[model samples]
Target: MALRRITQETFDAAVRENVDEFEMDPDEALREAVEQFQSQGVDLSCIVKAVPAATSDDKHQEQTHEILQALESLSVAQDSPDSTKAAADIKCFTEQCLLGFAQRYLAAQKGAYPVILSYCQKSMGEREATFAALSALSALTDGQPDLLDADGKRFLLDALEQHQDDSSVTRAAISAVRHACLKHEQNRQDLVKAGALPLLTSAVKRHSGCAEVVKEASAALRIMTFDDDVRVTFGHAHEHAKMIVLQHNGLKVLIDSAKAHNDNITVLSELCATLSRLAVRNEFCQDICDLGGLKLMMTLLAGSYESAELVRQVLSAIRAVAGNDDVKDAVVKAGGVQLIVIAMNRHMIISAVCEQGCACLSVLALRKPNNCKVIMEEGGALAAVQAMKSHPGVVNVQKQACMLLRNLVSHQPNYSQPILEMGVEALILQALRAHRDCGDAAKAALRDLGCQVELRELWTGKRGGITN
Candidate 1:
């Protein structure tokens, strides 16, 4: 027979029964409870398998955990006066347990998730308490995403839809939804199907002025674009990304949201990164340009010269949108190459900035000969060589720099000597030798730079090499 599941409260009560009624030793009581549960096929993986603490009034035992006490306090009926206090208690406990690496996980194991989720469902009529309960669920579900099952997903979506006018409630609930869908694929699909896309885009539109809401909603929107689910051979990442753009007017909403957050570097960085994710389509890339995305990104890049994180994201946005040929021309015409080189030079120590900067240059100089000249004129090639020199140990930086070099001279061979003068040939060779992944990119750069390279032939036109 399959073992039936029991709540932690039930198991804890059983253990307490053995200890108190039979006057058994605490260890013996716990052993008996474990044996009894396992004999009946109870899965103990989610169980804490420990004794409950005595009340604080009984000084003989240590005080129970604040988190546990809060959970217990929330399990009872909260009248008019007690509801506010209950909200405060859960909110405090959630904040207190937020920093621990595994406190929330243990809390969930102790039935904290259901308790908090139930409170959230019941307290929806009361905004403050609902926010607190939703906040608790968010904190608990952060690392333990599996706790967010179908019921939780449904509740979150309903809460988000119902609380559309309440930014705080929407923020807390969306924060929960973000944490739940983060690395869990089924949750992402279910939430999106349960109408997460429209709710999320609307949240961004409605709460554009609220930094916290916009930030969380931005993050949640980006999560919807993830293809992190490995079980499915073919992912819906591109489809979902396109949906967010076309079906939801995501580009205009995000662009408008970004404009309001120009002075806020963190929000700007997040929004910029999200825009890059949504730029999965050619026309979407064009739409980004149509929405003044390039102009906004260049403006942010120019002002954020000292902020490495923001500069890197801005470069990422620029790189993503430059997929369209016209956008590439616009980026170059906007002096994007000069700003990117300046950002790369300013933050050479940051491998991410260097990597993104090289990637941006590579994308801009892809097919446009004039853009390649602009890149060279603005020291784009030299910046790439310096990035390779600065972060040779980092394979991605090396790879992108190699790619940028390849693009620089792919169409305009005249720019090859100036690039070769930067001593990038040895650097390319070093990266090619040091990293297995950089082999193709580095060799292409070497070949295009008018250098001799060994090109391997996978198969010879011989009987032994013939599959037929």
Candidate 2:
């Protein structure tokens, strides 16, 4: 009966007969009808509806999950019984039920991503089942500020310690940690103290698991391991990076993975960005330069319109190794300036990627005066000028680009004169007109240009700087 689909009247008659007492096949009639409908490419929603919901919430959840799985299996099947419409219907129904239950269940649990972290271990065995639950759970916890509980918080760290073998579980566990970390600084410290950082760094290096899982772990690690104690925890991660820095093929794998998977983009970008951070350390820079990481990063930027995040990450990773004069010269020799300019031009066309691109340009402009010339000439200055004008709505991007200009204009006061001469001062003046956060950077940049306009003039153009 559980294995087949049946009709309303026939299935009702079967249920009434106590058919098992007579050893009757309860779903025999329904199964045949389902198979026939499938063979004719018909939707099976009517037949699927015949299966009764389980008696309790727990059983209902399981049955609902099973229904979702059945739909996925059929949809992906080489010989799907129904038309494409059936698959779409199944996906829609499953997503609605699954997301609805997950949200309500999680809201009931009140910020316990780790509860499903444990429950799914027992309840979910298949890959999609685990991911489905994790994805839904992520949505539930995403912006709910009041959801944290002490017990739920502890479960995340405990799961990391106990379940390192299952990357899937570890991934979800760390995502919970990341949510916690973002919610409170103490939770961030707790993650580092509970050995979460080591486990996450290990998972990121593996890079062979589900991309989403690996990236989430890396992201959690990136968020949690920035301060001093957590930085010490990353010592082992740093050592491991050193070993791989010299291995060309392994470094290539990280870059290629960063470029290919959209799911892996954030974490992979984080890894590269983190590696760039590590590369800022003298010992690590030596290892990266020896491994040819800078050249590979430069190569990544040559082909334009690739993933903006990946390009930004690669540029950041390169700056990690290119800290010294020799490394900077080598990067220039390797066409790094052209690629950076290309990223800058694309920055205007793309969003989000601009942050890192501007970050990379700032890194380069601070070190190389001639590179600033390349940037300003390649319309890098114009792009920054335009960004300063267009992106007052996004504060961080404006801050970074304006700061980059301050750095570039300072680096080559003579060369960047054209940028200043191009009415950039006026644009910065206009960008500072908003009272939002981006306005602060715009005023600072204006000050950098020797225009002693008060903050009030930039924000409200009043006669005086407003003091609270």
Candidate 3:
């Protein structure tokens, strides 16, 4: 006798009858039905689609019931004398169910967090179970962080402190912390205050070889160091938040991670972005350069990265570090000028990249004869001029371009003729008339160009229009 193939209608009818009429355990019934269908070589996706959607309240109650049941099963397994294997099995099952429930009914999953928290607290000794509980907590917190009450937050931090040697548990805890503080400034502050930062730093240092742990730890650190207020709070009088990162050897771990996972663009991008943000404070710029960040940035710019964000970050870091005259000379000596100009020409349409590129060139040209000469010689001036022309509508690009030109003309008058021959003066004048935000800088550049008469006439027309 041939076996009967289970159609979508047949599977749905079975699930409905078991769930509604017999009041069978929904989780058990669903699992058995799936296994039976798999043994029969029936496609299950169609059956999933055919299942009827529940009303909002029904859906919430359904998710709540499943979560509570999973927690109960985990609690029972934990109580067994030979609980390790059984607990692992139960935790895996619970995690899978919670993942599905969270995805479908995230808001409704809050009611089960207390049970989830208790499971985490109880399963602290069971590594697999603790990891599973933390994973679910991370997912739930990620979808709705408001569900993570103070007790839950403290439990996560306590888990991090206790699991310093356990890579799996530490990674999951870090993931939970990362999600909890993703965009919530208050949560980030709370984590920092709870000593989460040092724990995260230790996680990165200890799990140097574990990519997931390092990724999550670095991501959490990135968030903690992101807020300017947090930086100010953690930093000393004259120092910035980046100093906290540096104190923990965060930069070293970030650089090491980038080197180890050279192919992982997400890790590198986040690392570079965090580094860039840290470099924004002038006090930390030289520190970044001293740590060999300048060399790494040039190498990244030299390589082929498909992420424009990474390039933007590299340029922003370079711009920040170049503010220091010594680092500016270092950048110019390391062939950074040419690479920056190349990035500018390549991503001309990206206003942030263009703005940072021009800002870097402007800073590099600041009273530094070697840097200025390099900019003019390496076609940096042309890149800036072209950026201004191509993206006149971008206010910051125009502002930075005008400032770069002013610096070039003021510090390196020898390049004035070449820059003029490139028709930068025309573009500068156009910027003056087009963007009020850039008029002051544009007027200054024109005056430097010995076009005082044109500047006066343009100002006169503006005054005449205002008077009328």
lDDT of each: 0.86, 0.56, 0.72
List the lowest-lDDT window of 10 residues for candidate 1: 75-84
What is the lDDT ranking, best to worst?
1, 3, 2
| lDDT (Cα, 0-100) at 175 in candidate 3 | 86
Native RMSD of candidate 1 (Å): 7.2
| Reference-based TM-score of each model | 0.85, 0.56, 0.68
C-alpha lDDT of residue 35 in model 1: 97
lDDT of 3: 0.72
Which stretches of model 1 miss by more than 4 angstroms?
1-59, 62-66, 76-81, 460-468
Query: Could you give candidate 3's per-residue lDDT for residues 38-146 as a string of tens digits?
Result: 7887655323422344424565543223444444455566556775655564555445444553332422333456656776777777677788778767765664555
TM-score leader: 1
Q: CA shift at 3, candidate 2, in angstroms? A: 50
Q: lDDT tens digits, residues 53-87, model 1?
A: 66577758754545676666766534336666776
Q: Give Cα distance to truth, residue 110, candidate 2, Å.
A: 7.4
Lowest lDDT sum, 10 consecutive residues, model 2, at 102-111
Q: Which one wins on lDDT?
A: 1
In terms of lDDT, the poorest run of 10 residues in model 3 is: 231-240
